[model samples]
Target chain A: MSRLAALVRGLDPRLKLGTALFLGPALWLMGLVQAGVCAVALLCIVAALASGQPLGGRMVRGLLVFVVFWVAVKAGLDAVSGMEWAQVAAGAGDLAVRLAALLLLGLSLALSASARALGLAVAWAVRPVAGGERAWKLALSLALMVHFLPMCLATVAEIRQALARRCPRCGFFLRMTVIPQAVIRALGQKTWNQTLAVAGRGLDGPQAWEPDFSWSGRDTRCALVAGGFLVWISLSLPFLS
Target chain B: MITVTDLDYVYPGGQGALDRVSLSIRPGTLVGLVGANGSGKSTLMALMAGLYTPTSGSITVDGCVNPGEGRAVRAVCRLVMQDADLQMLGATAEEDLLLGRARTDATVARARELARRFSLLPAWERPVQTLSWGMKRKVCLAAALLDDPRVLLLDEPFSGLDYPGMREMRGLLRESRAVGLTQVVSSHDLECFIDLVDQLVVLDTGRLALDGPPDAVLNHVRSHGVRPPCSWSAGQGVRSWDEESL
Candidate 1:
């Protein structure tokens, strides 16, 4: 693995997650130039984090397709609402950049940390406010979401392919309407199966374990660097605007 | 041992899946559950695994009444669903094996040993979605075995396996049986388990059609939409599909 990948992977999951959470709102609140800079930086970070992973290429491609589709839809809506062409273009571009950056931020964290580590980080972060049990439940929910999203997407794709094969000449509107219903039915069955599988393993019981997290000196240094960067961004906000 | 008394499972939509089905499974015996599509074999497995409450009836697994002592039953039972994709709860084989359990050193070592035994050690860290259908099924089986459950239920365990995969699965089941694990395997393919199973239970249209040893149940399976094993049809005694025996 590259040094950058190693460093990102070695960082405490809590720090990585905290930075991502803070950067999401910060990216949107910044001026376009600042957001653009942040987006570029996030893109590089995501690339580094995703290096050598099997799902990295597919994830990046899927995200790119979604971003393009989102931009087109936003621009078309703005145009339909009778906005000025220049304003529509600018608004759509700004939203697309920020959205891409936010997604990249999330992707970087997901690629760097295992789902269990992320769950532990979430539990640790939420424990003070939600209590240990609720925090653990929330963390489990997050982990299941992480685990099921890809399966859901795969089910959607499978339904789409089956529909296309069986109804080759179906109109666009019919395909769109049928796909969601089919996906819901398929996902419902899958969800029930997953629930049974989990129950069989006795995972539905009360949380009996506590989260154990240790911080390293490197984590402290990384947190300080992140704090200084956030301070600089906060101070520069007015001038950038 | 598992005992079912007049089990009736009706779907929420009033569709009856299993009607008046009753059977008994002896301890430390491998039972083959054979039926056509939607014949309630999977439903019966789920009920025995403590996954669902029977609409009407009682299921006892090793002295624990299901839906009454479901948690206790679940503690000693593990079910491997037909669709391995849905059964997988982790991104990788190792993670799936260690999921929902205390990940102590001993558990981790057990998980690793199971992976190695199942030939999953090479791809232990790879995403399960990237594995082939047979490999994914093996991962599910390995995960099910990680807890050392007394009762193991497999639904359509041989559906997507190739010849070699089938051989490996048969070997695994035999190994489990040898170790006194009570296993109920549901399958549409008779040849896969005809010789291996100690007893055969056939369900036809959500009702018990036949239940006995393979020799007695083999001839009647055809009337219930299941084909007799090739050797049986060829006037030969019940035979295994294993090529080594051939």
Candidate 2:
């Protein structure tokens, strides 16, 4: 692994999550040039973290498709609202960069840590306000969501493929209606089965939950780097604008 | 041991999946559950795994009552669901194998040992989504076995497996049985279980239609919407689908 990747992976998950949470709003509020620089930096970090992982390339490609599609929609809307062509292009580009940065931040965290670690981080973050039991419950729910999101996506894709095979020339309107209903039914059944599977593993309660993380010098360094980056972004905002 | 006495499971929608089903499974024996679609095979396995409380009757696994001692029953029984995708709740094979368990060095070692035994160590760190259908099933099986439950309930274990995958699953089942782990495998593919299972239990429209040794139940499975193994129809008495047997 690259040094950057090793550093991020060894950093505590709570620090990674905290950085992402802070960086999201920071990216959104930044000037276009600043956002672009941050986006590029985040992308590199994401790439480093994604190295040697199977789903990394797919995630990056998915992010590209998402950004492009949304940017096109946003630009078209701005044009319809009678915005100047130059402004429309600039606004769309800015939105695309910020969106990509946010997604890259999320992808980096996901690639760097396991679901359990992220879940524990969530629990720790929420424990003060939500109480121990409720915090753990929320954390477990988040972990289950992370675990099943891929399977849900795969199911949706399979349903779409089956529908296409059955009716090659199906209307777009019909597909929109049919697909959601089918997906909901399929996912509902899957959720029930998953609940049973989870229960069978004796995870219905939070009594056995334990955090498998500890602080280290690397974590301290990571927090310091994140703090410095945020400070730099704040200090440069006025000059960039 | 698993004991089901007059088990009736009625869904909230007023649909009955299992109706007065009664059966007993002795410890360490492999029981093959056969039926048609919606014949309650899956429901019975879920009930045995303590996923659901029987609507009227009772299910006891390793002497733990289903409704009364749900957690204890769950501890003693593990169910591998029909869709391996649904059962897996981990990003990677190793993660899934160690799900719901303490992540100590001993547990991690045990998970790796199970993975190696299942030939899953090579894909130990690979995302579960990238695995083949058979490999995904193996990962679920390995995860189910990690807790060392007394009874393992497998729903449609052979649904998506090819010849080699099926052979590997059969081998795993045989190994588990040898270790005195009671197993109830629900499958529509009777051929895979004919020569391997100690008892064949057939469910017909939510009722027990046949329960006996494979030879006795093989001839009657056809009446319950299940096809008899091809060899049985060919007058080959209780033959396995294994290539060498063929």
Best by TM-score: 2
Clashing pairs in 2: none
List model 2 lDDT by residue over B107-126, tens digit each. 99999988999999999988
Expressed as tens digits, the lDDT of each residue in A25-129 for candidate 1 is 888787777678778887887787666777798888878888889999999999999999999999889988988988888888888877767887888898899
Error of 2 at A40 (Å): 1.6
Stretches off by above 4 angstroms in model 1 are: A31-37, A65-97, A114-116, A208-218, A237-241, B243-246
Worst 10 residues of 2 chain B by lDDT: B237-246
Each candidate's fnat = 0.51, 0.66
Model 1 residue B181 lDDT score: 94
- Model 2 misplaced regions, further than 4 Å: A1-7, A31-34, A50-55, A69-93, A236-241, B240-246
Provide the clashing-pair count of each candidate structure: 0, 0
